[model samples]
Target: MFNKKHYKFNLNSTFAKLLGSYLIIISLILTTSSLVFFRKYEKLIVTQEYNLSEKLLNQANYYVDFNIQWATSFLYSLYLDEDIYDLMFSQSSHYKKNGISKLKHLNLSSSNIDSIFIYNKFDDKFYSSLGSPAENYYLPSMKNIIYKSKNTFTDAFIPSQIKINLKNNNITKNIISIAILTSKSSEKSLSSAVILNLNANTFSNYFKHNITNNSNLFVMDNNGT
Candidate 1:
């Protein structure tokens, strides 16, 4: 006769208990490891994103500061240019032509410079590298430029001088202006200023080129513009 053996599983046996405990410990270890790994990965991703954003911001700030410094230095040089002084104080058209030509050349050579305006208080005349003089209607803003003791940066604004306009009359290109007040003599008040307009797209394009499409960026001064 063939013997048939049947075994029943005993839940309370020492061997069963030991096997259950081993399985429970292994499950716990796996769950804990998974949690720790996940947490570490999440933290690492956050840190990397923070570093990238910080680097981008620093690069943008440096670019803007460098341009401003360059503009400031250019203005300082203009203050020493005899042509500019003659254009402001003298009645000679020759000096005026030379100054205008110089401005035109400079404006043409620079990619970022949008427009250049030289306001002479003596003749109440404005000369521009863009050809036509700034309309006298904007005289208040011009005077404000000459009155400032320090170099001033303006909020993004539609230039009254640049006639280049979009199809919609109201839609005009925004420009940021850097103006410097200058005086030929120490005894005299500032009688002239050079207003240099920079295309707002320059900064925007810079950010676009350096940053990913998914990112959003803003450039603002203390006044929040």
Candidate 2:
């Protein structure tokens, strides 16, 4: 007598329960492995991104500092120029005019120079390549700055420390400035300052190009402004 009910399958059977438990344990193991792999992959991606950002920042910093060094060296060279010194201290207007013409020629030597101005505290006059009365407005503002170095760069102008808007040129742009006192003596109150203004586009463009859409980079001075 063969009875089929004796061999009938049942969900509540011990064997069925054991199979279900095995599947659940296998699922948990697989899930845990996948989670661990995902975390490791995430960490690797983060480390790679951090390394890239740091490298780019270092490169940008190098280029920026190099440009500033070039500017300061250029300014110092111009400061020592006999013609420039004569222009700053000469009593004759004709000699000063000649110096101004020489300044125009010097201004053309570099494309980075926005403008060069020489302020003689003795005569209370502004001599610049721009040859515009607007220099008077700008030169006075720089006079108040407590200079920390003989040939040091001014702070990067996020908003432009000295704004220039000339009617003839009609061009508005940001600039970084470096000024040198022309007097040889200790009494600097009556001395002249030769100021060289550099276009800030070189630095701004590098930062803009290196930064990603998700990241931001800032170049700050000692003041951290």
Model 1, position 148, has a per-residue lDDT of: 45
Tens digits of per-residue lDDT, candidate 2, 1-225, equal 886666668999999999999999999999999999999999999999899988987888788778878887888887888877767777678778777998889788887887788766668666888676666556654555313333333444323456556675655567777677654323356357777877777567777777857566678655775
Candidate 2 clash total?
A: 0
lDDT of 1: 0.69
TM-score of each: 0.78, 0.77
User: What overall lDDT goes with each candidate model?
Assistant: 0.69, 0.71
By TM-score, how accurate is candidate 2? 0.77
Q: Quote the positional error of residue 62 for candidate 1 in Å.
A: 2.2
Output candidate 2 Cα RMSD: 4.3
lDDT of 1 at 31: 100
Among residues 3 or more apart in sequence or in different chains, the pairs in candidate 2 whose N, CA or C atoms overlap within 3 Å are: none
Worst 10 residues of 2 by lDDT: 145-154
Tens-place lDDT per residue, model 1, 1-225, is 999999999999999999999999999999999999999999999999999989988888899888877877776676568887776677778778899899889887778877677877677677777673333334455555556434333323323333433344543455666665554323345556677767777777888999976856777756676
